[model samples]
Target: MIEFRNVYAGYGGGDVLQGLDLKVEDGSITCIVGPNGAGKSTVLRVLSGLIHPRVGEVRLGGAAIHDKSPAAVLAAGIAQVPQHNALFGNLTVHDNMLLGGYILRRNRRAVRRRVDELAEIFPTVAERAHEKALNLSGGQRRIVEFARALMTGPSVLVLDEPTLGLDPKTCQAVFETTKKINSLGTTILMVEQNVRFGLKLASHGVVMERGRALLAEPADDLLRRPDMGAMFFGHGIEDPTAAPQIATASTDSSGA
Candidate 1:
């Protein structure tokens, strides 16, 4: 399990996560959704050790990791696929996958074995093994990115907007791949822009506003709420029939 207890963090300017608290259960797919600048990506950054929380603690399986370095976090079994393209354009897809296991380069045999295993799982990796990353289509590249992230055999996979900007068919492909990955026993923690699709794909859902988690519950229940649109748009819920499980927050919005 992953837990963030009163986490407060941000870039150099100001706090993006304001006294935030969240929890991700083990072996579950937890999807977080919110409007722009709700600090969605920032949560993934804190988890990946790209930024350390100024206050509070982040724990993975009960081990505190808020202060750990990026490498340490990766070694501790958490891997992230960022929102933007991260592949080296000039490098071959195979080379990129090799780089994902750079820390284990000393054991060339094991790393190579892992790559071969992933290539079997992601056929695009095998079909375009020698092709430069720049040569693959957007969808193919994203698949390679997913395969590369698995090189470390992480217990948890963090994805930020995995299907952003893709065609509808590609979006479905990506979501299918996400499900396949989850079936392989890795816990998934993701931030997605497509609310309905994301909620449908997840076992649990979290709603965020102004850097705070406003609601956390089973994804189906959240999806069924009639005031979902109101929540995302910052309009107070007028539905007296709405679930009482939702926690209300101040109307003011800030941070990214």
Candidate 2:
């Protein structure tokens, strides 16, 4: 399980995540939803080791990893796929997958074997093996990103808005692939913009406001809550323009 206890973190300007607490069970798809500046993605960054918390503890399976480097986190079996493309546009799809396992450079044979295994699971990887990532559609590129993240055979996969810019059909495809990945035994922690869709796919749900987790429960229960839409998106049937109730001072309303 991944747990955060009273975590506090932010960019140089100020704190974004303030006294946040969360838990992600092993072998489950936990989806986090919130308004624009609720520190949703910031939570993922902390888990992935891109940033460290100023105060609090981040533990995976009861072990502290709060101060580990990004590479260290990856080696510890957490792979993160950012909101934007992290792929090398000019590189072949196959090369990108190989790069995901760069830490395993000494074992060329194992890397190749893992690539082949993932290609079988994600047919798009094999189909676009020789193509440049830039040439694929948004949906295809996202699939390749997932395929690449799995190259390291991580125990946990962190995804930030996996279906952000895809067409309806492609969006469904991506979610389906995510489920397939989970079936293969990797825990998934994701932040999503489409609240309803994300909750439907998740086994657990987390609702955040201004860096603090206000709700945590089974996804079905959270989806059934009458105030869910209002709580996360700052809009309900009656108050369409109501501002999201923030719990902190910083208002960097970009990602997370």
Q: Which stretches of candidate 1 lie over 4 Å from their true place?
A: 236-243, 247-256
Point to the candidate with the largest TM-score: 1
- Per-residue alpha-carbon lDDT of model 2 for 89-207, expressed as tens digits? 99999999888877645388888889999999999999999999999998899999999999888999999999888889989988999999999999999999999889999998888
Lowest lDDT block of 10, candidate 1: 247-256
